[model samples]
Target chain A: MSLQHALLGVLEARPMSGYDLVQFFDSSTAWIWAAPQSQIYPTLRRMERAGLITGDDEPRGPKLTRTVYSVTDQGREELERWLSTPHDPSPPRDPFLVQALNFDTIDAEKAHAVLEQFITEQEKAAAEAEAHRQRLLNKDTMLLKERLTRRDPAEHDRIARLKAHVFAGVAAVARTRAEWAREGQRLLTED
Target chain B: MSLQHALLGVLEARPMSGYDLVQFFDSSTAWIWAAPQSQIYPTLRRMERAGLITGDDEPRGPKLTRTVYSVTDQGREELERWLSTPHDPSPPRDPFLVQALNFDTIDAEKAHAVLEQFITEQEKAAAEAEAHRQRLLNKDTMLLKERLTRRDPAEHDRIARLKAHVFAGVAAVARTRAEWAREGQRLLTED
Candidate 1:
């Protein structure tokens, strides 16, 4: 999604400063859709100009003023409208697969080396993904336990199950990529 | 990897016209890195100007006068240098995750509907991946059987095992995602 849409979504949740939006993106959706702080602030300004969102509620700071943004009626209408539109998948843009396709051009030895390198990168990435997935799982578990304590046992179970499924999907993908790497290494060594 | 390095790596194997590079990228490396033909042809001309690659001995045709490219010594050195460098992971850019992160902000029912839509999309993607994995498996199986017939089984075991592992990994991931979709449907219905 565009940074604009992300910012708008955050504002729809609650009136948040640009800094808050940045923080939300980093801690919550960092793994899936991340944008730089640089992009966030500018998009906030642009959205304000377009009247999609506004920041009339400014929290005062001794040194600088922090603007808290809320979705205007127009903004909510836009988000509701955007939500109805079909979401198309972005075409894949993987470099490794590109190399693999034309691999016939390179000699076996050279292609093998590239494949080895690809495996190494995939391993590292899988490790990081696993770590992130674990952290999210822990957080989800804690949140569910808290909800259970508050007598909302149903909500706890509901969110926990959803969280589990999402992270399970992520973990599975990482595991698969790692397996692919090991297979790639074996192929390179043999031929 | 930059488009420049990827292009050089392809040429290092054998000289190819820009058109061929574009086609190769679509078929193979489209998974990793992708560049349009517009980007590929211009980059080739720029690489030529930079003395990284030179033209081939023969031209294919007048209109289709393919400009064959081979890596120069400088290009080879550059590609090798790139190979030695550590890789950086391209961050995931999934819009659905962005939307989900703010699910509490919007109408819960609407968000649930959006997620249901994503499940359908993920199912389609998983199906495509599974199909491709099966194709790879079938092709490798055929080649392995052919090798057995010829009694030249030296690399057969290695190739077969590697291909099998990679396909298994792919199928596993796809299955997990499909499972997630089923479990997720239950969670969405709970609220």
Candidate 2:
């Protein structure tokens, strides 16, 4: 369902085809909402069927045709509804944390290995989110530039700041996980 | 599924009826793994069918028959496998952050309202987790005490510590979210 809203949100920013949407998702902004090509096409189809979006076929070459997707008026209304609506925070269901809860079953070496693995994973995620946040702040993004043109010039910087802030929140979360892993490691040593 | 592993994790510590398991999840530890009774019954059925658990009919009274569940040797093996395995980090799909990514569409007051609501939610989560962590550390929890009795006396403190650490981690994550919400609220004011 979020994938649907995110798709509509992106289309509202700038209309693009499924291929371009895939490229858009693969870009630095992918950190915001990551969806695979497989998910993208099926969801776009569903959105089109629901009348939230529309697809127009155009000839890219003499023999090639591509469908460009854009948000319908209904899509914009849905987008606004989503923006104003309160979203429920998802419950945490981390398998690693579940494993950590049972660290008493394993030795310090094995448990330490588990915590270390978690550290690496969290650090990698934090690094990616942090890097993306930096790129967003520097205004070095292509897709965001396109999005900026859709709004007033006075609103451009805040838009970019909003995106950077979101990614920074992502980085902050990953950092907390890494810190938690380290704290778990420390507890193991005390045992 | 993590739910299966969590169920096994609980039963391995102490076996209980489906009703009792439902009560257990509703306890303070509910913060760790939140599964509804609907999900619990169906998942128990599936796990029983898979031979990971066994259900025995125990008569409580003249008219009441309860199916008590316990983990099998196979379930223990699966739990061990899960503990040692490095679970992949799930991708972030936060709807609030997704909304923040599109805040440029809404006014400052509206966006501030969004961030403010998120702050209240995060703060509530943080407080709950913190209280649970304190309960866990003081050895004042009913479930953890039962779980501790299953292990050697020498290992009891460490086991409690492990549970406390997990809840602390949860509290830390919630605090980060609340802080992030505050940051978003600040950004809205800056606009």
Per residue, candidate 2 scores C-alpha lDDT tens digits across B1-191 of: 88898898888878889888898888754777778899999999999999999999988899999999999999888888888877776665667777888887877788888888888887888889888888878878887888777778887777788888898888888889889978888887675
Please give the lDDT score at residue B158 for candidate 1.
47
Clash list (residue pairs), candidate 2: none
TM-score of each: 0.71, 0.96
DockQ of 1: 0.31
Fnat of candidate 1: 0.39
Error of 1 at A154 (Å): 7.4
Please list the C-alpha lDDT of all candidates, in the order they appear: 0.62, 0.83
**Interface DockQ of each model:** 0.31, 0.67
The candidate maximizing lDDT is 2
Worst 10 residues of 1 chain B by lDDT: B139-148
Query: Model 1, A26-141: lDDT tens per residue?
Result: 76555666688988888888899999998866647666677788889998887766654447656666544434443333445676676666666656655655665565446443
Tell how far residue B162 is off in model 1, in angstroms.
6.5
- Candidate 2 ranges beyond 4 A from true positions: none
On a 0 to 1 DockQ scale, where is model 2?
0.67
Q: Across residues B39-91, which tens digit of lDDT does each residue of candidate 1 receive? A: 89889989989899997756556654656788899988777666544355567
